[model samples]
Target: MSSSAFKSSERKLEAQVKLNDYFQEFHEKFVETKQAFQVFKTKSFFYPDPDFIRTFTKSIKQIESEVKEMGGSLSRLIGNQLGTHTQKTVLNSMEDVKPESHVLHTVSDELTSEHADVLVKGTETESITPPVSEAGNDDEVLGSALVQEGNVKVVDVKKKLSSSEKKRGRKKFLGDNAVIPKRPRRSLMDEYVTAQNKMKSISEEPSTKEQEAEYEVQTIMDFKKSQGQYFYKVSWRGYSVEDNSWEPSSNLTGCEDLLLEFYKSRLKQQERTKTDDLNYQVMPHDANHQHILHKALFSHINNPTQKDYENSITLLASPKPPVLKSQKEIAELADKALSQKKKDRFYSVAKTLVENMIMKELTGKREKQLAELRTWERNMNSICSDPAKLAVENFVDLELPPMDFVYINECIAGEGVTIPSDPVVGCECTDCFTDHKSCCPNQMNSWFAYNKLGRLKVSLGTPIYECNKRCKCGPSCLNRVVQKGRNVGLSIFRTTNGRGWGVKAMENIKKDSLVTEYVGEIITSEEAERRGKIYDAQGCTYLFDLDYDKGDQNLYTIDAAKCGNVSHFINHSCDPNLLVFNVWVDCLDPDLPRLALFAAHDIKKGEELTFDYNSGLNSKQMAGRLPAQLTEQKEEGCFTPEKRKESRSELILKTPKGNRGLQYVLNVSIFHNVYQ
Candidate 1:
């Protein structure tokens, strides 16, 4: 064969191979779509929700688009091998129709095994007769296989299917049924190419941004000015340099510190350049000039007393009268005069050097602190499962990190304190909330402490009885709230108002939503008293007494000063958003009840979390000052003791005495009553 003719035949074979690949892909996708629909139907029958319905609808639309894309690719591949007229006909027919409806079903029925061979290998005949269909009204689907005589001729392929030949759902004709013969197995090279094409298509598909929204700005890489506007090239955090983007200054709203630092460096560069240029211009080129000045300055700096000055003046007598004085004495007086004139300049340079050294030390310390805090932030979130992240921020001072502090998820038993790890008794109810009297809550003579939405319903100081490990209820049971851990997002940040470090809500929280459990070292009252004295002297404390009963000394106290969770940093407030409630899960000991903090009222994002430290939960003074809703719940009234115990010092992030007194809150709460 001639070179041109051979190339044309080669192209024809390649196109046929690609067409086979499209057919296989279309068949696979069709199966997936069918399976998805089947799953949707099953779910709807058992448990239906609007969200699932919307999701199914979305998936259907996406599948429809994907099918259309496959059809277009097939059309393009066929068009490359066939003549122009035939190509247009096939492309137009499949553009608006789905692959299953026309593309694959039609191809499968029309293209026989003999015809497929004829497509890959050229024929010698000039003119080819089209196959006759049993039904005269059969429609043309694709161009016929090419005849490779001296002149090529394309015939029309038709689909002759009657009503009885039609199929539905998964049983529809996929061009791979037993009735139709299979084409010869593809060559290894062709199969490899087909696999590569499939992978390329998959990689090109768009992905959802469910993992992360905004890319973190690692640092500003470069800055530029264009048309009176500044743009910063940002190096995205946790990404490579290739992903860096040029963002406008307005786009970097909260990066004021980064921007200012960049500008400061630029300013310093300009000043340094100016200084270098000034020095270069004034510097003398003469070999002896620098040596003479260095000698004079060194001499004057070492000693410039009255006697030396008088002697130098005497050596510099009038021209004819001082002929007796040596030339060395004259030069010495000139050196002394020059050094005296620049004495202030020497001192100024020395001062600048010292200031730069100090600034460098301070900058190094700040960077070190930042690195430590970033590490702490990573460690804290690594142990948490909540979607809301804990971020540490301190733009305050070079305050040293809290010493001997350890992050704990659960409370630790200290000296003379024991936590009940296993439950002795629990409800066997299938649904804890459904059978109230037979459930765990009934054991305490109390109803479930949380509602269906997991918000607290009982009044302040009421004990929360949550389902324990021994319960037959599932993880989603209505009675399980405090054991679920923190649901709302919180951040540990330094307050500008002298409050050392405090926790704040990162998202909106509803009233009575479970915030976080106050975890710390559980110690006896004696240990607490001994530690309290030391903490008081240090002007900081973390002792929270579990004094639930009135007119009684507390048996257990929680000290969060050293070993604690995020709640360790929570400060005290006169009117706080968070209220502490005694909660029981596995441990039913009333004296050692778990302290679960819940929101007192609705709280907005960025609000500080705090609780009353110097007063009891049942104190009338605090009750009167609290929100009306907190004090007057319909289910139960706030517990009031006949006589209140002395307020135990609460946990506070190490700050000055005046600053530690400032209170803030985290937006979180837990339900107090379960569903009926």
Candidate 2:
């Protein structure tokens, strides 16, 4: 009760007060945490509803906010208590006061329980659950409960039972009374046992092998029907009694047989249809008699032989007169004329006469017809020479010589020269006769010497001759005739009477070298249309100027012709060596946009130089119209020589030995010395 005792008692009382306040605050926080935890648990179910996700998230956020607030409050309270204790200690010599142990223990216990509840709720919510709607449905709840018990067997059985129960009291119908035997409700284990027994019975059946064979056959047949169609097949595994495991069936070898059977059946069906079609087709005898009679009667009325009758019919009908000669026939004649020697004149005259006759026959103009024919003949000759003229005009100042002066000779029967038969010596220019030693001694010497050193320049107009005797000059005397002029325009090398160019490539060309320039009028679409009329009337070959760019300067333009080219002589292959790319020679200058040929792809020394012209140029229609060789049925029919030649050309051009619509030819310059 003295001064010191009184101070001590005051300090004890203050300490006790501080401890009580701390306990109270801790208890409040613990209670709050416990309440939050309980709320979280109530929301977190085994199959938590999706709708509750937002609510759950909100609750968690709230709990976190409360925890932070509580922590701050606790720290402040602890700090204030410590400060009070320190002031008391400083004012008087006394020990610091501690919080109540029981209070701390209670707070710890509550917090631990709250934290455990939070973890439990999190885990429960995270587990797999039924969809939102199903989770809330009583039926789903019942089904889930049954499934969890491992008592539900087949899904079909459960569904059937569910349906029956739904309709039980609603219908007293006769169908409902026609009792479907009630599926005996069994535990999953019991149902599995039953299934195993049935499977065993099926496996042990005497006809199991036969059934398996039949199933395999059926599967194969079904597969065959679905060859080009998409489908899926179900495979079963064998049941293992010990492990309750299913093993896939083994050695499924009958699939091929089934496929063969299917194919055989399909083929038979096709054959049957073909036979029926043949039977239904008009017989040759019947067709011939009817066609001849029809032609005779049609001719009597139309009278194609008589121009007056044709013109009268045309005037009455006001229709365009029919062409007397087919374009195909004219093209054939032109090709033949180009190919022949002495007979070349005959073809030209014949083409002109035929064209004139056609015009006369169609128009039925008797007067001044001869004069018109003469004029047309002159025009036809001029137009035909346009390609040559264009070539010469373009190269006039290009350090190149005229094409007429260039003489080409084939090296045949060992290095001797074999002059071309066409252009027939005396036909165009005066015939020059020169012996091997006199006219072309250098050429003769070069052939005789066969030297390897230094380059040889063969001029355009050098005459070639074969010599039976060896040259007087030694092999070292390197003398070769330099031809007078340069050969211009595109020239193709082809073997005589061969389906295509023979095995050997033309000489004096190198790979990746410029071959020849295509020389033609750069006509606009309108111009082409106007000029195309003459070609159409004469049945001469012409090309259409197709606008590839449609105004886009970045793209290329193409000259597309309905008629074929030597490029068309090249064939199509799934695998091809040559590729075609448009090359502009003068890239820096726009005005000098000349087209130059480069190797489409790399070529071996002797390989044919070919390209897919259709590449980057074909329309969708053209692509689709290409024939499928595997699918087409071949038939015998009468064809003109032109058609036969075209067919042969196409066959040689296409890959895998089949008829193709388009043809392409090997560029001779791929093997020429100039290119090399």
- Please identify model 1 stretches exceeding 4 Å from their true place: 1-361, 384-388, 617-676
lDDT of 1 at 228: 63
**What do the candidate models score in CA lDDT, each in turn?**
0.56, 0.30
**CA error at residue 584 for candidate 1, angstroms:** 0.5
Candidate 1 lDDT score at position 387: 47
Candidate with maximal lDDT = 1
Q: For residues 223-325, what per-residue lDDT tens digits would candidate 1 score against the true structure?
A: 6666765567898878988999887654664465555455445333433453322332111122223343334333333434454433333222212222332
Return the number of clashes found in candidate 2: 26
Model 1 Cα RMSD, 1 decimal: 34.1
Backbone Cα, N, C clashes tallied per candidate: 25, 26
Residue-wise C-alpha lDDT for candidate 2, range 557-620, written one tens digit per residue: 2222322222323434344343331222112122112232233333454454443333321322
Could you tell me every candidate's TM-score relative to the true structure?
0.41, 0.17
